[model samples]
Target: MTDSSAPPPAPAGPLSGLLVADFSRILAGPYATMLLADLGAEVVKVESPAGDDTRTWMPPVRDEVSTYYLGVNRNKRSVALDLKDAGDLAAARELARRADIMVENFKPGGLRRFGLDYESVSGSNPGIVYASISGFGSGGGASLPGYDLIVQAMSGLMSLTGEPDGPPYRAGISVFDVMTGLHAIIGVLAALHHRAETGRGQHVEVNLLSSALSGMVNHTSAFVAGGVVPMRMGNAHPSLFPYEPLPTADGDLIITAGNDGQFRALCEVLGVPELAGDPRFARTKDRTANREELRPLLVERLKQRPKMEWFHELVAAGVACGPINTVDEGVGFAEELGLDPVVTPGEGDRAVPSVRNPISLSLTPPSYRLPPPALGEHGAEIRAWLAEPTTD
Candidate 1:
């Protein structure tokens, strides 16, 4: 919302001179470009004539704009183009031809018909780092549509998200989509570095299913390496005892004792120091194996105090524990720790509050140059820029 009529001056940061042509929509692609934009990339978000679908995902709105769209579309310019239209498609290809980077989450090979796939675009702009995201890989699973929920279910994440005896559940958020976006960013950065070294660029592909499997980490490893299929254990950790929430007088407090030392510390704080030396709970492996017996003993002491009191006391004793927090409380907790979790982009009237990027770089920190844009907010200017001859 920084008056789209006048482009904001570029900030001094990493990726300052990079031009990103964002042809992606929904969550994964847009989220990646937004982070690139934050890191000082000049991201031009190309949208269909009706705009990105998230623009209408409302009921959670700010100034009548969908917060869902705003959450991942800041610090970027917007251009509406109909890929089916000859004129607009030409303009889009022109944007791609001049971009240093390009990101899209269209179905596998979906952009081929429009001549915007990696092969076609890289043919014209050999240095362009093109990224493609999909639900699955481009080979056998090419035709399958990419959606986070489907990936969660297919990747076995949903099966491990609910209570042991209850039905499966998808995660509370599109975690795999976000993870894929982060992976896409990582791929683009690596490709850019390779381009700098070799004077050539390559296609970087990411899929939700693959990202999901990677994100599953230990759960996926349990099956492949240990021949053990992980199951839903509710709040429990499969390998570590005391790694989940325990009942307190008022509520549950998450406590994690990953090693024997932390377990000893936890026991000391709970006023059950003797439990740490007990044969059944003396070692990390022992505690994990005897968790059914150990859990009730720890819970007995935890229930003697309110969660917050226990939180302060246990944390002070070097035990990892805290009350489960809601989203708002999580932000407040970050604020209380002086992390400044939120940032507002744009100046006055149109400024929108957003979560700060998690990264912190001393030399070139992320910048918030613009708030999210209105549909086609910078179309005229972007089109004019695309019409100019490439300098590189």
Candidate 2:
């Protein structure tokens, strides 16, 4: 639960006055719109009569609400519309036509028949920043659904996870979806900037496949430079050793000795100073070559101490080390470290807890001014705002 004593004062955030018509659903689109809302944009989440699929993705429900849906829909309003219904579709189109920015993750040509495609909407909303998120680019792979697991497999991300000798494993989180969302955010921002200069809008397209490839920066670099596809090395880095999780007496601790000096400090902290001077383990390259041999030595020595003990010792010795923590533990640890990562908005039956946006600007901090809405909760209010006569 989030702290609910008093609401934090709103910051002068970027996008403070922007209006976003969010026609996207599920993870990627909603996540991007959440970011916009965090920066103080008024996001209208346009959903179908059946609601977003995430609204039913449950197990951890609060007062019959899906926690999954609540997680990313914060600081926004919801308006239900059945696109097939003529009146509802017209309302949706009006919202998009008047919006400063419009985002959608519908399948390729899915909204075209309803006259909501970028080409159609931009015909009237010439200054709109239109953005689209998809599983793949609007080309050969556009017809396929954009599931995170499938993108992970198709983009070679699964190949670079897990143990080297084990079958490929998907990341526990929807990494591809998250990455695509971030990319969509970037595209929308860039388009907005471009519109400011040109006084005309353009279509911005982002897809899971491209995002996954971009997210694989370091791993892809290794393959492109060495002509060898990276194999899953589990927690071990391909180019560094003593950088993987080492077994401790109680649990596991990850050590990230990125440089020779850090490696030496780690060795001294582990009571194995001689290991740092050894010819086969002298430099980063040498450490990588002798990782298999060095791993066992570090593991054996680390096993003598508990994870917390080693973590403290390594930190004091200027070596990067952290205990492997679960999601709950990580959140708790952040709170202990004085990082307020959660926010509670308002006092109402529909109020929900939301995580603060990670990005921080000194003059423009992200906000949690509103809670996630109930389905069509703001339909009447938003339609009234839309129907009000515009001076322009």
Candidate 3:
């Protein structure tokens, strides 16, 4: 960790002048704050002495530090403050008072008693963008904990996941937590725009349930607008034929023939061009309705080649197709395509690998200024700055 008792240099990105006081731990708030930090905001991560819970979440460790914690905490300074202590509380208050943005993920109204909630902080810095994230809305669900697994189960996501009749499974990643973080980012940016125009800040709120529902776009819309309750189809798309993985000689290859043209091409590739004109499979609706019958004919041809061989043929035919790749293979594929999927966020020996931020700007690209901080690694510097008299 950089152990200097001085503030870091000014950021050079689009959000260079912004200061974010981050009173969040775990995934959602930390993820949003990390993105802000990448955009050149100065982020001060406030934590209790025990530190972020993810610090102890292990099994995957890099240099003995929790990878889970490191993954979302780059480009930030850490300050450990026990809120129960008057001096620490004062320092936290000072940090919040000086910040232009504040983000927290405590349960609804959890920070009110500590005077760190939106109302309290905005009372002094009226232009601060205050963002709060929760699992459910702060309305009737305020008492529930904001666990991603619970949100996945409650948000109807798990219902749509898994093998058709098998037990529902949570996603390999905390999908809703990630979605909530992205939503929080959107809310904060919008609030910043509003503040720039009106010279006033407003509270920005995001919750996991709402983000999850919004993310289930096609599924939810099918029920609401079309009165169709969708169920798991075990990797099959409900409306499109040949949209699921098909067996090859060696493995499975996902093949999507989305239109009549693609269907004709696929039929040609299969050496059964006449099948494209067969009345039973002539159109999308007909193909979908006769999928059970059409499946075996396509399967018989696909089983003649290996997955990657079939993958190339299908792609060349202007049909979308690929073999499902493992995470390592996926990253390798991105690298092969010049996407540069991984990056190191710090200078010299301490640098660590990070997923490249997805956004691309013609100018003002995101930067990697700081490596993930160790627990209170910048405590001395942060506390010293917080002790100084505040102009705000």
Each model's lDDT: 0.92, 0.88, 0.90
lDDT of 2 at 134: 94
The full ranking of all candidates by lDDT, starting with the best, is 1, 3, 2
Model 2, range 1-392, lDDT digits (tens) per residue?
A: 12243356487579987889999999999999999989978889999989999999998998898989988898888889999998888888888888899999999888899999999999989998888999998999889999999999999999988887899999999998999999989988988888889999889999999998889999877778878788788788988887887889998888998999999999998899999999999999999999989989888899998999989888999999898788999999999998888888756765677777899888888888777888998888877777777776
RMSD of 1: 1.6
**How much is 226 displaced in model 3, in angstroms?**
2.3
Roughly what TM-score does model 3 have, to 2 decimal places? 0.95
Q: Candidate 3's C-alpha lDDT? A: 0.90
Ten-residue segment with the worst summed lDDT in candidate 1? 1-10
The candidate maximizing lDDT is 1
Q: Which candidate number would show the highest TM-score if scored against the true structure?
A: 1
* Model 1 / residue 274 / CA error / Å: 0.9
lDDT of 1 by residue, 1-392 (tens): 23444436655879898999999999999999999999989899999989999999997999999999999999999999999999999999999998999999898999999999999999999999999999999999999988899999999998899899999999999999999999999999999999999989999999999999999999999999999999999988999998998999999989999789998998888888899899999998899999999999998998998999998987898988888899999999999999999999887887899999888989999998889989998988888877877667
Every model: Cα RMSD to truth: 1.6, 3.2, 2.1
- 1 or 2: which has the higher TM-score? 1
Against the true structure, candidate 1 has what lDDT? 0.92
Ordered by TM-score, highest first, the candidates read 1, 3, 2
Q: How many backbone clashes does candidate 2 have?
A: 0
Backbone clashes under 3 angstroms, per model: 1, 0, 0
In candidate 3, how many Å is residue 165 off?
2.2
